[model samples]
Target: MTRATFEIEITPNETPLLPGVGRFDFQKVWEGDMQGRSVGLMLSAGDPASGTAGYVCMEVFEGTVDGKLGTLAFQQLGTMDGGNQGLRYIIVPGSGTGELEGAIGVLNLTVDEGTGEHSILLEMSSDH
Candidate 1:
């Protein structure tokens, strides 16, 4: 497998869906080792005080993956319960385009709690 990392900037707009449910639409710009942009939609529910909120997100990334040009789609599912948090992110099968066609991988996104710096790590099949 091959791994590459990229720094990301995300802009999100929250839209209320109901009393405790809402959606967030976001646009992401990525730089560093990978240059690209992505658009994402996310749905979240619950209150901060209760600490039982959860979210699911879908994002389409169009750009370079480790200097190789292509487009990819990924999904994220996460939940925060009390002081515990869990998240899962993965590349959508057959969603790679151009040079990334037929590529299979897992994607991980991380943020620094103090700095708020976001980054993505893509672990791809070596066959690509």
Candidate 2:
């Protein structure tokens, strides 16, 4: 397995879908060795003060993974249980296109505490 790391920026727009429910549209941009953009939609239930909430999202990324040109579909499931948090993001099965075809992996994200800079750590099977 190999890992690709890159910086990420997310712009989110939220709209109320129902009581205590919201729909979010995200525009994501990637930089620093991985250049690309992604569009995602998320459904979130509950507010921050609720202490417990969950969100599910689907994002389609059109970009390069470790310099390999292609596209990937990502699925994210996240939840906040009381004061704890659990989140997972993975590449959808068979969702890789072009040179990324046959690629399989899970995506890990991290944020710098001081800079608030986001990064992605993608671990995938070689296909290029």
User: Which residue runs of candidate 2 sit more than 4 Å off their true CA positions?
Assistant: 1-18, 126-128
Instruction: Give the lowest summed-lDDT range of ten residues in model 1.
Output: 1-10
Give one digit per residue, the lDDT tens place, for model 1 in 1-128: 33444454444565556776777777777777667888888888777578888988999989887788999888899999988989899888888889888877777778878987777677776345
Off by over 4 Å in 1: 1-19, 126-128
* Model 2 lowest lDDT segment of ten: 1-10
Clashing pairs in 1: none
Q: Among these predicted structures, which one has the highest lDDT?
A: 2
**Model 2 lDDT tens row, 3-111:** 4444444445555567867777777777755578888888888666777889999999898877888998999998887789888998898999988898888888877
